[model samples]
Target chain A: MLGDALSLSLGYNATLVTLGATLLGAAAGMAGTFLYLRKNALISDAISHATLPGLGIAFLIAVAFGWDGRQLAILLGGSALSAALGLYFVNWLTRETRLTQDTAIGCILSVSFAFGVVLFTIIQVLPAGRKAGLESFLLGSTAGMLYSDALLILVLSIITALVLVVFLRPIKLVTFDASYSETLGISVRRVDFIILTLTLAVTVLGMKIVGLILIVALLIIPAVSARFWSEKTDIILITSTAFGALSGYIGSAISAVSAGLPTGPIIVLCAFGFFLISFLFAPKRGVLAVALKHYQFQKTVHLTQGLLSLALRQSIYEPKTRRLLQRFGYIRADGVVTEVGKSLAAKTLLNEKRWSYWQETLRESDQFDGQVVFSLMDIETKLTQDQILLIDQGLAARKGKKL
Target chain B: MMSGIALVSDKGVLLNAAADDRNAPFTIRGLTVSYGQVPAVYSIDFTAPAGSLIGILGPNGAGKSTLLKAAMGIVPVVSGQVSFFGKPLKEARYQVAYVPQRASVDWDFPATVYDVVLMGLYPILGLLRRVSKADKAKVAESLAKVGMQDFADRQIGQLSGGQQQRVFLARALTQRADVFLLDEPFSGVDAATETAIISVLKILQLEGKTVIAVHHDLSTVSTYFDHLFLLNRKAVAYGSVTKVFTKDNLVTAYGGKLGAAQLDAIGL
Candidate 1:
């Protein structure tokens, strides 16, 4: 069953929903990159939550006009209006009052959502609202999605992606440095507005698929995960979009094969799975990479210290160090140093002596390059052959004078 | 407690000439800016001639940065008129370049050193324009000027504080504007970076471009600036470094915060 769903053989309706969810995920990921870079990821939460009130009001108005209250277009339009209003309120409160952005977002998010819940309960008690299935929007259920709803999601996602592509450069510049963007004749306020609008579009489109509650995850997690992969803005953006689309596609397919599973939680879980993978295994910035780097550094330090001990004729007490030296054939089980061990030990000792001599004597004279860091890395990598020879001569002269 | 000789206000005489000269790089009249109800900078009048390096000096919270921000229209001015080359700032924006303080932006943003410098061409390229090979060459040239050519591919956050400052200088250089406004360019930079920056400013001045920087170190003032605008919310003195950087001006700007020995050290 799962294979059939994954292959998009689960009938026409299922395929449409899966494809729509994929596009929605991709759009969210792309738009969310700018929001994440701007350091305003939580603003999407306020915008999504605020859409609840608009959804409820739009339902009531539709029922009063004797039309289908769950018409996807009408409901999404209402939610978009409310989400934009919520965004405006967040900005207004932040700018006009002493409240910070987070504080303002919290205020609007709770108040608007609570008002929405009040309307939701009122609708729930009514006779016509009993079969409304509005509860599906909370966690998202594509079980009975209409053809037009799927088409709407697909169109909006494509439009969002196109708009982002056209404005990507300016959006990136503004996100990186707003003051500099303004100096360059780009309107910072307009760019900010465009970002907020894109964020709103993604949130509203995500309501029928990921639901309002988990939509913020779809918008933020992919971008955050992508940051672990690359340092370039364009690469991060593309990687995040792909991650989001993958999550949406797989999550919807899995949900289609199961009888009672909702698509929203599964989609969020898929995105978190991607986040977990990137967090643990991505290169450079990932957990595994960092741990590997630390381990390598530790091994180098232990080897250097072990060599120093052998040079000084001291006993090697650390078992790991002893095993490392033995594995490299630098030492024997009977605590005897080999010819290679002796040569390495002597070189290490000489390097240490030259380093100290340079630090204690020639350091303040400014004769050597100050950029060379003598610790951790090999001294030879940092200094020229002539410079190392000069340091060695200085070390020998100091030893002769001490003698 | 102000003890300076009462000199004639430089406002009225320069105001008419500033409008007519057309060569004056920057001219400001009655510039006032406030944050909330408190004023950051009061009404002030100043002008910078072409081919001169000018320093805006003041104590902490004395509106030194606020003055430059106001002139660039980054902050809303309560009442002021700022002109570049005898034209309003908007009309001559392409001819002006601004380098904000390094600490003002998040260094952890995912951008390469080359990418940040390439942003200098955004105004010229505008929207929907591709960066040509010449533009890339210009970015390389600017990076080479600041000794950061080798760091083009390095992430911006990977650089040291001095290297970061140099990257911003390189970005400003890429703009190739006629007038440069820098906010605390030398602060938190290494000695080498400071020397490099001052030399670049000197070269720009020699090339007949106007350079105005918000400077903190008083000891380097005489050597770094050809003209000084001593400010503490308002202009205290505005003229050549030898004439404006006197004991009275320091006392008024700092409000006796400078010890007599400290003033003597900088030869005030």
Candidate 2:
């Protein structure tokens, strides 16, 4: 697509558009980070849904004025109004009533969007000889974007980014602890207003490409993936923008060149791809990685448990007696031992795995050298195997208690 | 001054009746904090001498945390004057370090323990002064004092509750402030965490700092603090533990017949 766009001599415009889209996505990522942190991801979604009415109104004004007159101004103004109203209701429902934030967000989204649809329908009730260019604003289409839209998005994105940076420390402090931030001389009201205002500005600007219904995906997906990539504030912010930019470029190219595909879903899916990769491959917190770690941990524990049980057998058993005892339960007569038997392996393998299972109990007991100085009775006043293990694991069960 | 002292769980054990410094670090007149139409705190009065560990004690809704917040200038005081070293909080912003409640923040926020501790330098490093090597050293020193030097680079969310609390204390230490306001710092903490924070505060107190903490669980109030401020919608008592933390004062602070909440004993 880049090659084709380049060959046609429209390369510069294409690059500019991609750059503009990337900038838009970056602002979305930055704004979305706070939304994710504040547990207000759905707030953006609600704002997006509510902006549809603003679109129809802006279209009416644009048509009355002429398409070339002041479309950006009217569009931004309408979306901003819708977004503010959405925010007011979100705050009202969540604060004034006992309704959960999720419920409030959903109610605002559905009702406001339905209103937008009704307004669009009323305006076009008679098919008033004019094209329904206003309806196109509902789902968004890049066909209408020109260099002017790019410039507007750029200005809005810069302002939004600046806001995020200036209030970075306060925002960080509050996201970590709002009540404490209030205690430390920070105003929750001002911070919340800043966040919401930034969200509104970003939404109005991005409504060109992703439209009102799907701009939220552009806002939220990057931050959600960022959670999996880094645990540091600065890194999370940076990574969110980078990933967001990547999705923006990919979504734009696909929508522009593909035969048919909704740009909104494409951008969201691109972001979801990033999220999926992070969730699966992220070093420690990733879903599959954590699960794999757990599996390894459990396997080691079982090996250790088996070794310990073997140790409980008489020393007279030496090596063969242990194997004979093992054969009683795990060995196969076909001379091909079971997988568990193979997993148990030699003493070396069992010993290697032993720490996985035994670490917890021995840690509780504060035991070293396989020699537990404190007996279960001495440590916890009971002789249960679980208690002994807990004691060995150095947990509260036996931490301060005298054996 | 005692050797191998076990950290007091509440304001009671750590505060000695004699720990009061002749130089009081703060004074508040008619301090009040309100949330919109609701009054989280209404009219608080108190003074703390420098180098003293004071506990602000009350029941769940006694506005203990709110009082501390008002003093810190974090909570808006609908009407009142607070003086730190005889100046307003804005003039003395760098001199105050605030350690918030453990549960008030999102622990899963992407920040290293080191990065979090460095936030304490924000008042000093405000505007465009880059966080210098000196600031990094202070963060390390604070983390080390909290026995969290080894975990400095670890993500805050990955830590246990006690560790996260210590990290917050580390940040406070980096503020290098003359006073500290901790909201429910000891809540949900283990013995080690209690000890760690007490030790850090000791270093601060030795340097003649004033430590005011909003603490629940009244059992340890007498033992933990040199002074006590018992507040429930108003100033109930403010003075030395012996003078203001008496049995009668306990009843008064715990809303002794004021509000419906009775003094519930929780081991300090």
Candidate 3:
């Protein structure tokens, strides 16, 4: 198994393709961090989809000059041009037309994608268009990548990463708060334009590796997954880039081993896998960790309530209640209620009584719903019938009457 | 003498610093701000003294925040000029700090209190320069001032509203600016946090920093500020608290609905 893995990695074309994909992933992920934090993650999708027409038009222009239309530089330039135009269009629509940002992005995304589809159809029937091999970009065919294609991707990725490092401070501030950054003497518009241009560059270069349709996954998945692991922006940026590179390398390798599978879908699937793992397993922010903390909180609330009830009934906790409270660290081994336990009981009782009073008051006004109260509490344990009845009586007696 | 420090003229005067060396610490001339042609702050003029706490008191929708934003150049001005230390905003940037409203930022953003505080050092460090050990030490010192040294590494989202306000105050302190403009700093803060912030503001005032805040609670205005700017789209009154915090000023600012008893009851 070791030999097989080594041989697969050492294959000349496989190594180049994987290296190129990995670089593209890291670059996209770095740029994606700013976009994600600024709440504009979908802007990448809009830009990527917008690049399709650029690729088609570039091919047509190259063919008109009797040159190979698939030249890497020319194609990527066209993609970048159209992506910039799409960005400007979205900006204009949102600013000048009173359309919401989501609406602007959606309009550009759908319109540009549909126009590209039309251009693709038109290219197919042209005399030399049948040989353009532009279809490979739709669902990236990594096997078709020449050494120069991989080299182009590698160069762009290096440039992008360098730019990000040089401008890290301003980018960090702008992402956190643009208006506040302005007060620090930073030009918010200039920083925003720089970030958008960098994102466009990454998206244009990434289209060949992940395909325009799925490149957004490479951008957003890693950034969001990184959020589950760290709370610092620098740490999140580094972790996200690492996750992106890992996804690219592993996804490309898997596709290389399996014939007839496309690289783009495999890469996106790999990113999705990482996101799922982070969502479920990451500490502090993950689903499982939050569920555990919530469960512990509920149990503490129950134990505190039980202690309060016992204290009220007999001026002491019942033996069973005391043992439960002790096990939960609400009481000391000497059978005395600890300070923390006493405060917890008092706090819980206060909140319960407050909510009960509100419920009773609302009921007298013909506006109460027990289910609404339960749902608002949002606890897993159902309140027994007797407990509800007791709250009702307590609330009524507090109102100068008994139920 | 600090090369960039603005000096107050002896005549309680606002000088054009290019002609005379003495400069007012903060001044706004004919400042008007609007949202898409609808005016928010209209033709306001004021010259604030150095080393004083000023409260911007106004009713809701009175453009208190808009004035602050316009001063910071965050919002576009219809026609106005804002000067700090007798210089343009960009030139005086390092000497001035603006603490935005607490609700303006996403607390869930992936940053710890320390990380946010360190952002104060960015403008001083300028572009492409990494923060040094000295910067980190300064951040810790600022956190200590706000009684939040123990929470330096805590994620900002986990903090209570008052704790979050303290963290922001610490961030502003880290900037070490001579002038501060805070927007609604005490709106949602607990009494303890409010007192703590007020004490810190007092210390800054003692150190000769000009602090202006958008304040909502009329009851605390007299104790919090030495001067007051009562505003409603226009400057209704601007002077020392003792002279400006009057029943007539309150009525004008609140559209003539507030009574003298109401002002007296609030300790005005």
Candidate 4:
């Protein structure tokens, strides 16, 4: 199975596709770090969704111009234009009105997606008929990605990565604090536009592999997962890139072997698997690590409570457990407690009492009082002779009180 | 306090060198800023000379913070202009540093103290330039100034409130500018941090770097700042702290919420 998987990974038919996807994923991850920090993850979603209408329009224009509607360059150009327009609208709405970034993004995402759907339906009924697999752009079908298309993705991804690095300091400053950056003389709007344009390019290019709907997952998940592993920005960026590359490579390889699974979904699933692993297993920040810490804390508290009660009952501590309990300052090595410990023990004993049935522990009217009696057998095994005698007397006194 | 004196004050107190000094670190003229329908700061005018520790003080809604932001062009001014060193803000951008309110930033942002401090070098380095060895030294020196050199590699969010403020102060320090505008550097910080910040501000003043800070605590106002600007959607008073920090001005700024004795107790 390993050999077969390795063979599939290195296969001629899959190599370019995998490489392109991997690069795209890495770019998205790098760019997504800023977007994520800015709390504008949905902007990518809106832009990606908005590209669909452009694709439809581009295809229509191509057909009108008597050219091939499936031409990659024309379609992508249209996609970029419309996506940019969608982003502009979002920015305008947020600026010119009371609508927040989230509201603006939602409006653009839904409206643009609806327009694309309508256009898709309209195109299907035209003379071109079904638009020659243009529907694959919706969920992304990588099976037909030509070598040229793969090359385009690779070059775009590399350029995006290089640009991001070049402007890393300014972009980092702006993303973390746009207002502050502005005060420091960085044009927040220009930096913001740079980021938006880069995102637009990456999202449009990535649509060939992950589809409009799932490309955001590739951007967001890897960065988010990387967050679980590191707190430093450079570390996060590098880790996110690695995660994205791994997801793209592994996801593509899996989809290749299965033959039935869609590349986009498989890629997202692989990213999600990494996310789950990070969520559950990453040290310090992961769920398992946090839960383990919490569990140990609770166990310690539980044991301390038990030891306190047992000490109240005059049971001698086992040397090993006593040493542990002593480490917590709950008991002395010589086995005698001060007033503070006595008060704590008294409080613990009182906490176990039933306030609603106080009279039941007193003298009862009959031998069978219907009141439940707790067994001290567990406490007896751990108690010394003098302590056992005191317990026996205490039990007898309670039994003798029954009428 | 002076290299030379050119003074102007409505309150007749010499706060610092006057607008005639030509190198006044900040000059705001008839500046008004509004949020939608409501005005936050209205018709504010002041010229802070180089080497003055000025405090912007007001009640919660009095727009003390807004005045600083508006001056820095972080908040849009409805009217008027702010100049740095007798030049427009854009022209003298290299000489201005702004430390935003501690709460205004996302603390969990993926950056270390060193990363954030290095951001101060960006304005000088420009978009395509890289950090030089001197720039790195400046960052280290700034961190050392704030006593945070040991925590340069620690993530910003892991810092305590005071340490975070120190980190921001370090960022501003790295600017090596002639003017620094700090928004509530003392808020949520311990007394020690407050003292550290004030001492840093004093050092900046001695070095001829003008510092304007939005200060919330009125009690420490007299001690921390030599010059004071009290605001209540408008400029209530601006001059030397002893002259401007009067009970009547406090009443106007705080809308009679503070009693005269309370103001007196705060050493108004």
Ten-residue region with minimum lDDT total, candidate 1 chain B: B1-10
- Model 1, runs deviating above 4 Å: A301-342, A349-372, A382-403, B1-23
Each candidate's clash count: 0, 40, 0, 1
Question: Which has the higher TM-score value, candidate number 3 or candidate number 4?
Answer: 3
| Candidate 4 chain A lDDT trough over 10 residues, lowest sum | A368-377
- Name the best candidate (by TM-score): 1
* Highest-lDDT candidate: 1
Per-residue C-alpha lDDT of model 2 across residues B109-196, encoded as one tens digit per residue:
7788887887777666754478788888999898888888878888776787788899999888887888898888889977677777
TM per model? 0.91, 0.78, 0.84, 0.83
Inter-residue clash pairs, candidate 1: none
lDDT of 1 by residue, A1-403 (tens): 8888888899998998899889889999998888999999999999999999999999999999999997888888899999999999999999889999999999999999999899899999988788887777777778777788778878877888888888878998999989888887788889999998989998988899889999999999999999999999999999999999999999999999887788999999999999999999999999999999989888888888899899999998999999888888899878799999999989888778878776786553322323434544577876679878989898778789999
Q: Give the whole-model CA lDDT for all candidates, comma-separated.
A: 0.86, 0.71, 0.81, 0.80
lDDT of 4 by residue, B165-193 (tens): 99999998888888899988899886667
lDDT of 2 by residue, A1-403 (tens): 6445323334555555566677888889998998888888888888888887777777676666666323667777887887788889898998878799899998999998888888778777635414566655666666657888888888878898888888888888777677655545677788888898888888877777777777888888898888887777778888888888888777766665664676656777888899899988999789988999887665544444444453443132244434553554444544344556544444433333334334544443212222332221123242456744544455433445765
- Where in model 2 is the C-alpha error above 4 Å? A1-19, A62-70, A92-107, A126-129, A158-167, A179-191, A314-403, B1-24, B31-42, B76-80, B217-219, B232-236, B251-268
For candidate 4, lDDT tens digit of each residue in A187-250?
8899888888888988999888889899889889998999899887778888888888888878
Q: What is the TM-score of chain B in candidate 1?
A: 0.92
What DockQ does model 4 achieve? 0.30
**RMSD per prediction, one decimal?**
4.9, 8.3, 9.3, 12.5
Ranking by lDDT, best first? 1, 3, 4, 2
